[model samples]
Target chain A: MLEGLLVDLVPYGKAFQDLDHRWMNSEASFWSSGGERHFMSEAMVAARHAQWAEERERTGGGSGVGFGVQTKDGKPLGYFGINWLAPAHRLAMLGAKIGEPEYWGGGYGTDALLLLLDYTFDWLDVRKAWLMTTSMNARVMRQMEKVGFRLEVRQRQSALADGVWYDWLAYGLLRDEWAGRATLVEQLGLRERAAALGSGAK
Target chain B: MIEGTLVDLVPFEDDFATYLETWMNEEAWFRAHLWERREPHTEHDVKKFIERMEKDERGALIGFQAKSGDPIGALIFDHEWPRVRKAEARFFAGDSRYEGCDEVLDALLMLVRYCFETRNLHRLDAVALPFDEAKLDHLRRAGFVHEGTLRRHIRWDGDYVDMEMFGLLESEWPGYAAKVAELGLQPSGLEPKPKPEKKDEKKDGTG
Candidate 1:
């Protein structure tokens, strides 16, 4: 269902060094927020490892982006992931930890979520996708909504960061949306699906 | 809180007859519907009236038993305002044993909420008679506003009487539901909120 260049997954613990500079930029806390203070040390890292591993053990999820995100020239910018989801539900929650604050507002989130959602719904056959973000992170929420997620619900006093609870916003999107594919199809001089559907309409 | 185990309108025929008798005599507008201008001759007539409600083109029962549980009130969907998705309501405790009671008012409020929030209808309206002073007071207490009066709206006895209109909007249903739920007397079968997810996407994806 999707035609594009495939992403190269960086090997586990292979010192994806180019990606390391971005990682030390510590996008995890930049996105997860509160730096190392909120969730501390190797214990926190072990917990992260266990949480994802247990989920994978239960649901058989693939390693998100195989380790890290890399640009065409091999410059690593962010790490992306897809939470395994069932076909009928059709949506896999997605997130990216981009280390570079310089790259924060520069379309990195949109491009990565598009690429992840593109893979989840098309290659993975996801029909609907949902994700959550906090009201504190209005920037990320806007990036999510720009990619076609509409607010479905909001939970109050749910985010317990820095010993305080913040309101969390949840959003959802459907597969029929993905303007990039239509733009690409147009760019590549392909027949519009409307032409194919014309006969069905009759 | 007018609640008891719900009984179908058939066995509760006396309740229906009592409801009809008071309605016919008390409101000049209802007198015209009774062929005898008195009570139904038998339980068969009350059953026939309820059965006739099923044949109504609206395609669903008009009222439900709530608060007092013997079908004392209703939240009929799509009774009028075809384009807007609206309903009309009228209710009474009916039995001479229960006149002047406010239990049916609680029942009507429950029914109004079921029609608006649960059924997703935009509007609800009630038509009352100008001389029907106390019922109009009940409607206002239930959060409905008098929209206007319809002069010569229904022929009563030998003459038409002015009819009063009351209306409510769906936007007002939630606060009303909150107020009603506080009474611990709910319209049967209304769910509270979103069901608990088997696994709530945990905060920080660490559920």
Candidate 2:
């Protein structure tokens, strides 16, 4: 059994899970809308959205924060969310799924992961974050690093990918150890976010 | 819109909602790339990604914005892989009055200034699918060097798709900028070239 390479840690929404059910299996990826193996169905996407809603209430999180992804034309694509978030722990698990494989490796999976990391530490005051990936997902390992996750542990032959056991890679990061947060803030034009803070402020 | 002019790896987290917006941006990027590859990502997956990013700062993201008053399609200097200190110069009509994506590489020169000269970065690089002949040609026109291909690097449609990487060194950028400047807006349009003037029809018989 190998660790998962999913970009988000939260259970997927109906749309997202649909993506997961499709891409999680290598064979189903062929019927993807983008001619890529990474597309999901509607029923699968909603389930994850439910979890996201639950987590928001438990954490005083906002519903709009529930993340959504789509192409420029506004086509629903995949979904992501923060799971197992511990305010005191300053830690949260991130996860995402793209049913349309055409968009796989297109930078969204990794970029979306970084987006959440940006939110938790700066405004949310979290200290750090971590994630897990299967040894079979070398591409995912690279993607994890691209978003700045460092390997924390490697469970030897802990999981299976193709009837063979592979090591699972667990990666994490601290706020101070992070790079590009300030630039992203500036990039996002949110310097005045100070005025936007507070649960009821919005 | 505080467009991306300067960029660096950001460790600080973004607001939960803002992070969601960033995820939307990623979705757009993925779609653009998918169009090149002839596909798309999960439709709503990108927005979910933004929310997740709001939870932590494991992977620092870059910021991009266009300068105010700079033509919407004129000056688009954005960082792609800032670790490589590179930014993108986009020029798209987007189903509007505009027609093509020709000025993409040419617009990059101004951004190269912002990166190398203003930001004090060293080198810049860009990637293009070999199938995206238009984009690839623009890079070549902008004086970008064809570095090499990773070959079947990206998994697409149950298999891997070949990807080509191109690079433009800081040292090479200055001369290229000069070449483009000398031409002024003479080569403004990205449309395919018209037939050359024939020798018999030459106005000054210089041919």
Candidate 3:
């Protein structure tokens, strides 16, 4: 399991299926509003996990790494992952969700992002990370901006949601920016870790 | 083979793998354009590559000189989204001799037509390094509009580089037909002529 201040990143398996199913059937739609929402089944989630396992093997440990975000008491709250990874280039794409509506607006999502970004830049050795979200996702946009992601571009009228067209916004953050977020990096002790990694420290 | 003006896209064969390896690793502009390390590939690696291409739904075609049948490059339609009917097109002119020629455009035209007409795709898109001005201009002439730059999207030569994205919808193809005609971008031997040549020339009536 991956450690974090507010949550732990646990492996995905059959045990988490119930909460994952509920998440997908309900709260997940608001996040991926551009796509047609449908009922998700355990079989589909199992197949996706199997695919991720194959991808990890294919990329030789350089591809997607998925995890279930859990609380200190071992309650699964949501999911997070890094995909489309190019280890040689030190780049990857990131995505995450805190599916439980009661958990929304709490610090869990932000903590998950911090931990994931730290893992991406530090452990994965990825130098840059990026993601795309719909223009209507103001909550996610504001949170990402706080973590130093810049609004790079807006793909106009790229998505159709509820019979309306919306733009897709692309955001990116460099390792330097993450390291320079100052308070968060210091609070997470990532600054010292980064310095040590630079000087070949563990 | 998918025929074009100067080139034909032949189905990729196992024997062509080594040649492709050379082009990807030894070609002049390979490093500048491809955002990856130039690692040497063994025969086993080549075999794995061929197997993956054979199994992948994404189309991979080898560009060959229509007249001489010599391999020139590779054209790929990757990241296909069947639900959205969109795909990303990528090409590398391994044979540098055709860099500035219209052969690349001809090959692209053939591929674009196949995607829209044969494959029934709604959109075709591509990404280019910001430094690739010639390719950007070529895409523009082919009616692809600039979408936006992905800031620091790729790492090339130990530095971060931005990628400029371009897209073309099937609805826009007709407007680009005129440009294609003006450039005579067609199969090599099919260029339209103003008139047939006279068999005998009258040299000021002195012949």
RMSD of each: 20.9, 22.8, 10.5
How far off is residue A77 in model 3, in Å?
Answer: 1.3
Query: Candidate 1 — what's its lDDT?
Result: 0.50
Using DockQ, rank the candidates from best to worst.
3, 2, 1
* Per-chain TM-score of candidate 2, chain B: 0.50
Query: Scoring each candidate complex against the real one, what DockQ results?
Result: 0.01, 0.02, 0.34
Stronger candidate by lDDT (2 vs 3): 3
lDDT for model 3 comes to 0.69
Q: Candidate 2: where is the Cα deviation over 4 Å?
A: A1-66, A181-202, B1-207
- The candidate that wins on TM-score is 3
- The CA lDDT at A187 in model 3 is 61
* lDDT for position B143 in model 1: 77
- Model 1 root mean square deviation, Cα atoms: 20.9
Residue B101, model 2: lDDT of 38
TM-score of each: 0.40, 0.35, 0.77
Of candidate 3 chain B, the 10-residue stretch with the lowest lDDT total is B190-199
Instruction: Give the best candidate by lDDT.
Output: 3
How would you encode candidate 2's per-residue C-alpha lDDT over B121-177 as one tens digit per residue? 545555666676666766677666765554333444565455565656667766544
lDDT tens readout by residue for model 1, B81-142: 33345666655543322333354456566667656656666667676666666577667777
